[model samples]
Target: MEALGTTSLGERSPWQDLPSELLGLVLQRVPSHAGRVRLRAVCRPWRDGARLQPPLPPLLPLLLQRDGTFLSLPDGTVHRIPVPDGVSCLMSTGTGSMLFLGHGDGRCSLLNPFCRDTTTPQYVDADCFGFQIPSGDPIVHNVRKVVIMSDHIITIQKTFEGYNCALSIRRRGQSTTTVDVRWMPHVAAYSFDAELFQEKLHIILSTHVGTIDLYVMDLIKDDNVSLQCILSTPVDNLFLPFGHIVDRYLVSSGDQLLLVKQDICKLYNKLMSAQFEVFEATDLSNGHAQWRKVDTLMGRALFLSAGCSMSLPASDRYAGAREDCIYFLCELGCYGIRKENLSFGIYDLRKGTLLSLPSETMVAQQGPQIASWLFPSNT
Candidate 1:
């Protein structure tokens, strides 16, 4: 106890010697992942304490840039990662600094890029890479997004004319068990994306007839699963002029689920301008779920993309976070790598304005336009 307050006989007490119990309390109050990383940089004791206790809200995710490089987050430092040949990072999985790697031959692996000992953790054959799907249907699947949990991998697949969107759930060390719930919607309906929110998985399906349906799936005990319709809301008429396009994204934020709509206007596929509308669910659990518009997201910010969409606190500008912002991908033309074509920006919800990523980050490196946000798992 005295050591915490008093220095050594002839020298000052260093931060490296701070008690683990005391350090953990400080870590919990850290508002951003980058803040924790700075604390870990102090000394071995601080680093060990970070790994042992595991800070709050997990670590800030690394931005996987186009050219197989990693943007060191808030700082925006670029790192070239030599991923295994023929394998690509599918997304971030597990806990800390780990990634889900997809092999060219159709297999998956889990890797922690920070470590040298790389061992493939899990495997899903490319045969379907589709969660041990039964060999009966002959439809080419388009997976919207995959949520990888500790014990379960839930994939939300796209819908086709005759085939309904399928949610494939596969667990580890078990017989090929799957939660195969095929939702048959209108042939004209388009599946936007899926989100794992509030212990349940939900997929958004927007019909051409001006309606949005939220299909919520609950994975229950005894391997039982059930589907519920939470938000089946109608959209206002957007009697639009030519060259206007709208895309909706479903994101799970803090304690609420947000439905973000991106309105893009273009001429001859050239960039014009865009806007975002944010909405919150009123009666999320009740059968009659509804969405109400929210001008500000309190102090939280969102990162939106096709591969992954998530919400994180933006309370700490010192840790490189901005409040009430939506970071989105906007490739002017077909998703491409052309310097002039790669258009990305951060939309300030509070100000109702858009801001581009730093100019340095924009021209640093470019690869496949398909980039992903990764929150690593140490486990």
Candidate 2:
């Protein structure tokens, strides 16, 4: 038997030195955010061509903190994402693309996480004045929510004033998606809160009365989307309109359709008729028709946030404290709710378990509610 030749020289590369593409694939599966961060710093070619990749499919939901940062809960674990330049907004639409609106510009941009491809519609200006009036009068504020589905249907709703536009989602690498509004009268006073339920896109609108009008559109549907009346409020006098501008009119908590209405008359009489009814969506698939009155958060309340209970188990209760949970930029920020004085306050629903970051650390976050869809394990 011939003896195998032994090489005295230094050995060559093992595993035949993987291809550049294969090396990148192996590095990408490292599973650590830091590992990916390090991989980006390895080489310029790697960073640009291999490391900084587009987001994967089945986009994950993320919440943007007040500090202009995005938070993601991976497997119930929190992960902070680095913001790239030119990114004005970091709203995770749960559509595999984060919504980025330009600064002081009418154009809104959608960035794909997987492809790193961006689509910008310069003419697409969304009005966002919201559903809050300073003197408690409902007026048109030009605020609107525009949703673009994967299948290319755009549904928009103007806040408070009820202006709505249903336009065809413009094909990428194309020009105008605008319709000939000159021939038709514009529908005014349309309000909608959008969510993805049962693998379908559901836009919930409200009527003159408290009944909910659900527009169910399959992301894959090319036919005309239909609007169906789903549920009506139990109380006659109660109009489950959009909560104050601060409250998230968009399907509160990603699931429940929140309607915050108070009996101002009852507050004046100092009676207990101050009811903030919460209707739980029974079935979001069939056009949000089935609803049940859940519970009333008893008190003269203001804003709500999905937060953890600092002590005991961190429950997903609304975070601000009544005395200490002050709303910044509102009424001089002293009278709203102070985060420090919440320890022994009565009207505060924190139950002495409210978790708070330092007030100095927390700048003002806009909107009526602050929410985080942490992984189920985190909650």
Candidate 3:
């Protein structure tokens, strides 16, 4: 009989010695963030091969602290990542391989974490800017969010003057997404927030009248991708169109579009303190959808910020994460960006209550919200 992990000839099993190319191919199929963790634990060769994979898919979201430490979720794992000097992770690019990083010289570059040297960076050909960054353009100064998706890149920029804003959706290869601009008479006046749902790009546009509209860009449609309005504030019957609305986030939950409304409770230091309300879309099949207040998120949890938001299922592995809760950051402005001063909290949907991060967890994080939320590509 053949011995364990051995052939009839008594040779050692070759399972540990797979080819690099084949390993890379296998790694591509591993979509779950948690699944990757188990994949690396198989053996030394497997771990090494997984690490050597060209572009590491973003693992479960981590809070990037001010001092280059990573605070992982659910497990409360504290990791000190060796980030290079003068380079700071600016935000997630919606992909695991590259991120938008900021330098000391007011310059920003695209950083691929899997690359050999974190010290050096070059320009990424995102090409939506059409102009060099740091060029003193008012538009560049107020750039709010830049999300890189599979088909196109979405850039949202807001200027303080009259709350002016613009949404530029550009395809990767020198073209632009066909947006339905007939409704938007003036791009500068309309302020909006966007997210991806069901393989489509969705956005929430807030107008001066206090009304908000939800629109979706159907990329998978025919040859021409077009934007279509799905719902508006009046139809939702939930949002009252408050002028005090400062930030609204669109989080795509499992087959659900969740809206997180943040209203200004207090204005201090040119920033407004946040108060939140959750709403879930209803009857989406007919295009004209309505919204209803969502008291719970089932077993899923949400991570949100001014610029980004993500939803994930709470599992046993993430012991620190609470189910049906929303996790967010607040600017305490006490220690001037110290991790301790950046107040983090988990809001319980069931009880409509909030619980702050424990003292130990806060201390592990550095004070920074550069990358608003790190969403997994698989999601």
Best candidate per TM-score, number?
1
Ranking of models by TM-score:
1, 3, 2
What TM-scores do the predictions have? 0.74, 0.44, 0.65
What is the lDDT for 354 in model 3? 62
Of candidate 3, the 10-residue stretch with the lowest lDDT total is: 176-185
How far out, in Å, is residue 67 in model 1?
1.8
TM-score of 2: 0.44
Which segments of candidate 3 are over 4 A away from where they belong? 1-42, 45-60, 66-69, 74-89, 94-98, 102-109, 112-127, 130-140, 173-191, 219-225, 234-246, 264-275, 316-320, 330-343, 358-371, 375-379
lDDT of each model, Cα atoms only? 0.61, 0.34, 0.57
Clashing pairs in 3: 65-366, 66-366, 74-318, 74-319
Candidate 2, residues 250-333, lDDT tens digits: the string is 233333444432221211212121223344566655554665554433322223222211111121232312332211111111
Q: For model 3, what is the error of residue 146's alpha carbon versus the real structure, in angstroms, after optimal superposition?
A: 2.1
**What is the C-alpha lDDT profile of model 1 across 1-379, one tens digit per residue?**
2234335664545766778888887876664454566666766667777787853544345666656666655556666656777663345431224565655555656566766445544465643335221232212224445666656666655544343455566664443423333444543464456777776677787776678888787778736667777667777744656766666888888888899998777554322277899998778756667888999887888877666778878744344347888877643442223444544567898888777654335433355434556654441
Global lDDT for candidate 3? 0.57
Q: Whose lDDT is greatest here?
A: 1
